[model samples]
Target: MALQLIALSPIVLISSYLPFASPSNFSYPAIFNFGDSNSDTGGLVAGIAFPLGPPNGQTFFLKPSGRFCDGRLTIDFLMDVTGMPFLNPYLDSVGAPNFQTGCNFATGGSTILPAKANSTSPFSFGIQVAQFIQFKTRVHEILAQDKKIQQFLPFEEYFGQGLYMFDIGQNDLDLAFYSKSDDQVLALIPTILAEFEIGMKELYYQGARNFWIHNTGPLGCLPRIIATFGMDQSKLDEIGCVSSHNNAAKLFNSQLHARCVSFQGQFPGANLTYVDIFSIKSNLISNYSQLGFKQSLAACCGYSGLPLNFDNRINCGETKNLNGSFVTAEACNNTAEYVNWDGNHNTEAANLYVSSQILTGKYSESPLLGDSHLLAISEI
Candidate 1:
């Protein structure tokens, strides 16, 4: 059976148990995000050899911002809702003028675990945390040299009050699945969570108090997964997703949720909220019609004529076929009607929906962002 089902009722039901945190007067001065392609703004494009071009960011930016999707990612929308400027990638050639606001340390193919033996890049979560540490030191140095910028150099004020968002672990799980048995993959969960715990503790030591942690989504439902692993009807669940893979994702989320609960108990005065992206993605699939999504199991952009309209060899923007023929990948006229943007990511519209759900604070473990004690700090 798939891992225990998450509450999929209306938003009201899911949020009924959450303690009310009023949003009447709340604001976040900065947001520091860490993750992989799911939340990468431009780090991957700037640092890696990944191919990200047109048609990827056509829906919103009208040009590529190095995000894997056509428009804004969930992190981008979160910033918009919080009134923060879109985060600049830490690796961007043109450095952001203001580190006071925050910077993104996420790279596209980043994993929580160190890069595998065969992996091409070594930008793991550990490295991102190291970068954050370097950034903190740089801020202190600048503050010491110039009194004019000292206001922005308040490490405790900014780091303690800022919101830290994490959207990693998907790539780690994906690698595990392809290389190890189901039981082996399950065994890796504890190690992954340990890395997360260590990372969080380091941040806490550095004055980061508030955190928004997103669990992995339904991996089996991705277009690429459906094409690769859902070929057999018996293996596919009622939702046209591979049951085994989805079950694995559920297991990971379950363990992660429990860890978050433990973290709350272990760390005094820390606000670590777990975001249930698994349930949100599942709900979207189960309620696609109500959500105005016409295609829930296929990609909005990919090579045409392939199973589930996804071709592993081609990306979203490539217009030439593998045989050197001129053939463009099919893209939906209205991306808003599709849940997936490419084979592995969500469309801008779907991201908008997901971000709205997260903002509702119902999906979080404690007081929603609006009611978060971190936001209560009047300094911002």
Candidate 2:
């Protein structure tokens, strides 16, 4: 009956999907989310939640999850692991009772800066951050109305009792390169990082401390990107990895890691740690089985034929028995065998595995953190 359960019931009912969520491991009081679709939870699809995605999440939702994948996303797994309630999108009607365990200020395609023109797009990273600031402001203003900040003793320190997760920046690359030049994009990375710093400081200034920063995933491997532009899987770098897009992704990861490390150093009392999702994603691609994933590169549902493109691509959920309008290209009997659920995102099963790795040692294919790793808080 709680909101998190209400949100998760459909996801678990259909597939008995194991999200790998560790609700028992939450070390922080609140969980703040910001990012694109990967960690969106429910920002991008709020407007079009009915039409475009029903076909996408048909298996579970009996409708659309509005998520880019076939099942629960990485954030769902994180909340489950931490023992926190499912995080509601901050912008939801606020009709859902008790909407404050943590709010997702993340819109699907929104950016970091306060740009007026991007509202039409998915919640931009900048836009999402701004929304959080607004939410916090609203909370404070209302508290003032009731004289609660001073009168309410226990709730006084609510701001400091939270954790934040930000996984963004890939969309900037997509939008910039599509419209601007590569050089222009490269130049903007510094500016992007700077804005990111501002957002971090904004959260810190407001009392947020526990933070998990995720790096961008490989852009080159996505089906939508690769369909038109092909990459030769043969070339290997010093690490014996492929060339082209994923290579660029590798480069981005390096820079992202360095930037986060610098941030951790700059922010005082902020327990910020880099998630290295880039590295984890890369490894999933390199060896699917190594990560308990089946297929890393290809989409499980879509046109698996000689002709490949966006129009030809399709997601899992709907059964298109229509004559020629629908054609199944490639599909694994069990999605658990594949990493990618759609063209660009991972399947629910895939997300579970990744979330396990992120939680340190609660669950994972490999050990990445120490047993001494403690939750930032003791109370759920």
Candidate 3:
């Protein structure tokens, strides 16, 4: 599959100027992120009981820290590429670490909309923004107490110069599909984008200038979704994915790109870059063999089953007894050769590849860190 570059919005084309100081001279002081499991560092561990034990983070962290992947997420890779330290979850044990550098407020199962009336967790996108406000206040108080560290005092210098990323909306769509038809799910895009715009505007008011927004990926092609919906041969596309879901994703991405254009007009100084992860991952799936992936549609670490190797009853690293024997979910020896890690998330290897490709500025609405900057950061 040849990599195709999505057309850039006019505002993005004009705003491609590198604003920060040369990477050799200065680095982004901090990075703040908002989203769901796609970027959650450890928020789930702090807020809920999600079993992200052994095989989950074994590929990178060596132990589970509430991440949904079998290793580092896209956010983790972005931190590495930019020379920033891994962010600590804001909801982690009170004294676990300091938040001077930055903090992550994302949680698994979070959505852009308010949780259902009966929902228990209040970690919605709006709530995450509220947490960020609280974080800013705490950082201000700490700087006030220590005069010597007051350089990081002013909000603009502290927040505006840093990177702010968002990797949400997947859960919103997921929830919608549970009780709605395909057209109904498509109808919800406007509401979802409206909620996201509100959040982005709030952040802009809070002094965020550099933004990296990731559009949702192809949710229909996920191994779990495929196994559930791709039972009919006629319903599958050439690539073996449910066409309706993927089409819905493409529709969402289109609207998101247009909204980003309007956002640039609203805040001309803000560098808001849209990342087309849909194309990046879709191409990877289509060319999995060339990309070194042996299993593109099946999970690498999931319970073995009939139609596909994914079992909802047994998550990765879990075991179940059938009849007289015990069957356990296990990780494959060659994780790097698979795109989907545990049915929904990407493997560490896939994340690494996607990060590298996006950083090259091919899939971004605007150029990301330049080669010189990347080189400088990598050396650091």
Candidate 4:
């Protein structure tokens, strides 16, 4: 279950970004984002959760919106590309007054299985989408004053064309695969996949068309996991991938690829594209030097723990005596050199590269897949 959830985080990431930028076909009227930390614009929920500290948003928003990353999540980039209002985080009371443009219902670490563990950043996709539906209802009320759908021109013709994107499904697998017994882990995949499919269908029923689906990325190479497990390089081959973790991720991605193909075949209006973000991500990490990346195996915002630092829990602000004066977070002289920001997530520069592949993939969608998937809407 955990592996399946994480595998789908790429899906959520792509969903949020598709609307964030100008789609090759045309710009979306408005982008509705639902899921977890992958697409977070707002950091934490107001009153519901406390705001995090400085390093959290050290790069972009520069003031922690409760996002797990340093700067903007996918939604901010989408706004820039599409020329739309930055979707307001659902928690902002001020924005709610007349936020007919669009909104984000994403929270950190939410998962599909309520019983799933808590390692995921915030809210589950199911919970976030519910909030999005409520927000849409409010928007409908506001749009009542105007036409059912506003028409701007050749560019804005598809504005507000119900572009709902979700980024989720990773944390679920992380908990199950890493924490549970072997048999227990295998037992959960079918049930988890079923719930995930239902979740997708529900979004379609709620008016989400032109879907952007992302498959799982490589999970075996997390800095935190390596730092924690302390696996001697001698035990493994040149690649640095843990034997079990790599095998598990391969299995998950294989199933995911087949399922997405089936999904595309069955769903007409819903056009699902399975993105192999894992290979790209793995290659980037492995070839960090070739990619002009400085730090590949360390985390910029985590804590290097006592025993289990496989994922390198090195916190951002700590000071240590390295060569002479001191050293702190695994911060590189240049963020572009580092593929990972924290142990589990990637930095802004890496996301740009990943998003480019997603936008150009064959699954590029239009307003929706009509009888004929025209370039007007079919461009990724």
Q: Please tell me which predicted candidate would have the highest TM-score against the true structure.
A: 1
Q: Mind giving the per-residue lDDT tens digits that candidate 3 earns over 1-380?
A: 22221232212221331232133433667788898888999897788766678788887678886898877887786676455667888888655465656778889878888877655356999999998988787777877677665543334366878878888888787667768999999999999999989989999998888887889998888888887777888879999898878888888889988888888887888887788889888887888776656778889888764235797677788888856779988888867767888888888777766765565556776433222223332221
The number of clashing residue pairs in model 2 is 29
Residue clash pairs of candidate 1 = 56-70
| Winner by lDDT | 1
Q: Estimate each model's TM-score.
A: 0.87, 0.76, 0.86, 0.74
lDDT (CA) per prediction: 0.76, 0.60, 0.75, 0.56
Q: After aligning candidate 1 to the native by TM-score, how far in Å is the CA of 356 from where it should be?
A: 1.2
In the range 1-380, model 4's lDDT, one tens digit per residue, is 00111222332443554443444444456666666667766635552565455566666565665666666654566456555666777776753332455667766666656534434344566666666567556555655666644341112222236465656565566666667765676567666666667777777777666655555566666665565443776534466655455555566666765665566677765655455667767767777665556666666565453222223323555556654656555444455555677776777666755554444443333322323222333233
lDDT (0-100) at residue 98 of candidate 1?
55
Report the Cα lDDT for candidate 1.
0.76
Q: Answer with 3 or 4, whichever has the higher TM-score.
A: 3
lDDT of 2 by residue, 1-380 (tens): 11122122222422433343334445566777888778766666674452344445544455565676666788886676566667777766635434456777766665554444644454566667767778778777777677534332214355687778788877766566566655666666667777788888877877787777777887766665666445444543333333454555556666766676676667657676666677666666676664555456667665553222222335444445546675543444566666676666777766765664554432111112222233322112
Model 2 spans > 4 angstroms off: 1-25, 47-51, 58-62, 94-97, 113-122, 143-156, 180-184, 231-242, 290-292, 306-333, 361-380
Which tens-of-lDDT digit does each residue in 1-380 have in candidate 1?
Answer: 12111333223222331223233434567788899988998887788657788888987789887898988888886666455568888777565345567878988888888886676446789889988888878877887778688644445468778888899988888778887987998889889989988888898888888888899999989988888777889989998898878988998899988888778788858887788899888888888777767788889898765347898777787876577778777677878778898989998878866765665555666532224332332221
